[model samples]
Target: MSEGAFKKYGKRTLVYLFLILMSIISVFPLYWCFISSCNNTQQILGGRMVPSTHLIENLKNLFAQQDVLNAFKNSVINTVLVLVLSLAICSIAGYGFEIFHDKGKDAVMAVIMMSMMVPFVAILVPLFQMFTKMGFVNKYIGYILPSLSTPFLIMLFRNNARTFPKEVLEAARVDGLSEFGIFVRMFVPMMRPTFAAAATITFMNTWNAYLWPKVVLQTPDSITMPMLVANLLSGYVVDYGVVMAGVTICTLPTVIVFFILQKSFTEAVAGAVK
Candidate 1:
């Protein structure tokens, strides 16, 4: 073979080898968790990696808890609500900031971005006090409100929106559509990939939210899935098998959503603004 051809083959081979190694590293934890979830705490403590005969028993114990299924449902509801509300708010904010342009909006966006640097824990005390005064303690709304439009997501949408074609928007206005109509009818359809990307991220963030939910939700009836998983180990003797099963179950929805939006994610994240 020619030297150039051999060099090309060697580079491609190295890239593939690196990718395979990274894939294994990323997936090994989930694989181990699945294996561990199928065994009892004693077997897990013994460092077993292979699947055992206790899978059904582990699942039974996880679901037999009264709060498990309810928390799962609450998680679904909160995730869906956050997904819908966050997409609407962030998409509009992004489009307006990028397409419309204003000094005041720019200043406001800067402030919002700066706020992200402050740790959520720093604001938890004030937020809890405000929620208590407003009677949002132990409420689903409390779980869904704090993250309605995250700064990182807003910036993501804005950057993506900047790539949107200006000519089409002007043409829509020439056709006598109002500003809101132009946004809803013209911009939204063209930004389907962006919306899909936003929905996937917002849903995952909401589904996996734990610290805030645990802090504000004082009652079992309103607790979320992550909170429930955490509560599993509150007793003197922790059950590793049940906790791993709960973790596996908690991981499925995010995985499913990512798979469903995989193509959209790639397409939306690609390209840059002119």
Candidate 2:
């Protein structure tokens, strides 16, 4: 090979090596979590990465606590409800903003984007008071309602909707199809990739939600997985094995969902970017 070609190949090889190293570093924590979950109490406390014989014991302990199952169920319901409602509302609003243009609507979209700039912590006190006034504290609705209209999801949908062919929309209009009919029949099917991406992200966020749920949900029965994990970690003795087992259980659903939707999710993002 020529010297210049050899030099370029060498630089590419170095870049590949650097990326591989970074990937390993990024994935190490998850690997450790899994290993620690399967380890014995001694191994976990000792900070060893290898698995131990206490896997069965940890699993048994995790299942023996009845509250864990209840918490899991509550979390699943809350996550699913939040994902469904949030996606539906955000997607529709996004599509509307994109397809039905008006100066007033543009101002409204600007306001929605500005709302994303406000930190949740800044609004928590007011939100808590409002929920309390409405007697929504400790209710599933309290957890799901505030999140049902995410600005990010709306933005995502809007961007994806831009990819929809204007010709198709115009043709539908010529066919005497109403705006709503065009959106439902043509735009919705074309945006499956975007929906899949949105679903994956929204589901994971809702599933792993900690702060809001912790504040709103007062009872054990109403608590979600992250809240339960926080409570587990806060116990006086802090049994690492038990905590690992709970973490494993709590992480499984999101991981499974990601694996299932990963292809479509990637395609969705790519399509949106295009």
Candidate 3:
């Protein structure tokens, strides 16, 4: 090979090596968790790296010792509701902010974005008191209410919306399509990647949420997966295997969602900056 070609190939090889190293670093904790879940407590304490045959045994212990099914059900319900509702509300808000021309819209968006700077903890106590008065404590509504819309998500959609084809909107309008119809039929399909990105972010955030849910969900029956895992660690005698099992279960859904939407998520995030 020519010297320049060899140099180019050498750089590509170095880049691949760097990426592989980073991938292993990123995935090692998940690998450890999965493997530990499949081993006995003794094996885990011994720093076992390989999978063992005790996975079913650990899972059975996990279910027997904890309300795995109930927690799983609650988490699924809360995550699904939050994901669906948040996406609908935020996407529409985003679409409107970008698609509809209004002199005051930018000011409204700036105010919304400013809210992101306020720590959630600042409102936690007040929100709890208000929810208590409203009788939403320990309810799914309490779980779903706080996350129904976020400024970052709205901004995500708005940025992507700016890239949407105005020509299509004009054509649809000329054909007698209403604004809602244009958004529903045309904007949604065109912005699928952004929606996928938003969905993945929302699902992951809602699923793995611990603090707000822990505070609002006062009843034992309303516990979520993160709460369940926290319970495992809270006991005086923590079982390594069972704890790992609980963590694996808790991590599974987000991992699945990310892998499924990873391509679109990447595309949408990259496009947002442009």
Candidate 4:
């Protein structure tokens, strides 16, 4: 082969090799978790890489010993509430900021944007104190409140809203459609990709959330999936198989949701300005 052809093929081969290596690196932990879930503790501790016949036993222990089903229910409740309220609030806020076009609103948005720089951990203590005073602890509200309106989500919608054609709004207004009506009927349908993207992100984050829920949810009845996994990991004797089983269950929903919305997610995120 010519030197130029050799160089071109070499570069392509190198790129493919790098990607394959990264894919293995990324997928290894998940593979390990699944394998561990299907193995006895001894097999796991001995670094077993292959699947075993212990998955049913591990799952049986998980369901019998832990509140696996209850945790699933709690996680679903919190995730659904957060996803619905967050999307509604952030989308509307984003629509208003972009469509309204005023200096005062812009100033308010600047302040809100400034909040993105403040880590949630920095305000976690204050939030806990405030929620405690409000008697929100151990309640689904406590789990759902903090995430109902995030700045990043609002910004995402706002940037995408800017790309929405203003002519549609003008025509709707000329036809005497109310602003709320227009938003509900026109804006939402047109932004399915963005909404799908937002839903995927919100669902995953809320589903996998550990720390905030851990701080608020105290009762056994209110425990989430992550908390359930943590519980499996705890106690005087830890069962690796059971813990891995719990982890697999906890991780499954987010994985499913991502795969379902992945195409829209990639499109919307790519189209997001900045």
User: Listing every candidate in turn, what is its Cα RMSD in Å to the true structure after a full C-alpha superposition?
Assistant: 3.0, 2.5, 2.4, 1.7
Worst lDDT window (10 residues) for model 3? 265-274
Cα lDDT tens digits, model 3, 1-274, are: 6999999999999999999999999999999999999999999999999999999999999999998999999999999999899999999999999988487998899899899899999999999999999999999999899899898888889988998888998999999999999999999999887888888878888999999999999788999999999999887888899999999999988888788888866765575556
Ranking by lDDT: 3, 4, 2, 1
**Top-lDDT candidate index:** 3
Please name the candidate that would achieve the greatest TM-score relative to the true structure.
4
- Cα lDDT, all candidates: 0.84, 0.85, 0.91, 0.90
Candidate 1, superposed: residue stretches over 4 Å from native: 1-22, 263-274
Give the alpha carbon lDDT tens digit for every residue of 128-226 in model 4: 999999999999999999999988789889988997898999999999999999899999999988898888878878898989999999999999999
TM-score of each: 0.88, 0.90, 0.92, 0.94
Better of 1 and 3 by lDDT: 3
| Deviation from native of the Cα of residue 210 in model 1, angstroms | 1.1
Cα-based RMSD of candidate 2 = 2.5
- Candidate 4 is scored at a TM of 0.94
Considering only N, C-alpha and C atoms within 3 Å, which residue pairs clash in candidate 2?
A: none
Model 2 per-residue lDDT tens digits across residues 109-139 = 9999999999999999999999999999999
